[model samples]
Target: MTLEENAREHPYEPVPGDVVRDAATRRVGRVMDRMGLRVQLRPLNGGREWDAMPQDLSPASQSDAMSAAVAEANAQSWRGR
Candidate 1:
C-alpha cells in the first residue's frame, strides 16, 4: 500500500477548525493545524496556541465549548478594562 494509504488507515487527527479539548486540563480550543507531529490549538478568545497529541485530545462537549467561550469573552472584557 502507498504511504498515503497507510496514513489513511490510521485514526483521524483533528483537522483545522475542529473544536477539541485537552485531556489533561479539559481546556477547550479550536484545532489549528498539525505542527511537526503535534496537533495545534488556539483559545476561543485569542491567546497563545498550544500543542497536544491527538491521543491527548477529544472533541469538546457542547457545555464545555460554551463554558470555554464564555471564559474567553470574560477574559477579553477584563483585558479591555
Candidate 2:
C-alpha cells in the first residue's frame, strides 16, 4: 500500500512501544518518537535507529487477523468476570 494509506491505517500515533518497520530494509522496530515515528532496532546489536515516515508500512494481514483474535479473546475474558 501507499505510504499515506499505511500511515492512516496504523492504530496508534506512533509512540514508544509501538511496533514499526523500516521501509528501506523491511526490519521491524519499536517506535521511539511519537511525532516523527523514529524507531530503534538492532539487527546486529547496537540498537540502530530507523524512520518509518515517508515509508510504507502495511501490517501483515496474518498478524492483523491474529491481533484481532487476541483482542477478542481478551474482551471475552474481561466479560467473563
Instruction: Quote each prediction's TM-score.
Output: 0.79, 0.37
List clashing residue pairs in candidate 2.
none
- The TM-score that candidate 2 achieves is 0.37
Clashes of each: 0, 0
- Given candidate 2, what's the lDDT at residue 29? 51
> Candidate 2, residues 16-71: lDDT per residue as tens digits?
65454456765555445534444443322224465556345433344644554466
- What are the candidates' C-alpha RMSDs? 6.1, 11.0
Candidate 1 global lDDT: 0.87
lDDT per prediction? 0.87, 0.50
Q: Name the candidate that leads on lDDT.
A: 1
After superposing candidate 2 on the true structure, give the runs of residues whose Cα lies further than 4 Å from its correct spot: 1-12, 34-46, 58-81
- Model 1 over residues 1-81: C-alpha lDDT tens digits? 897687668755789999988986679999998988899999987799988888788788899999999999998999899
Number of the predicted model whose TM-score against the real structure is largest: 1
Stretches off by above 4 angstroms in model 1 are: 1-12
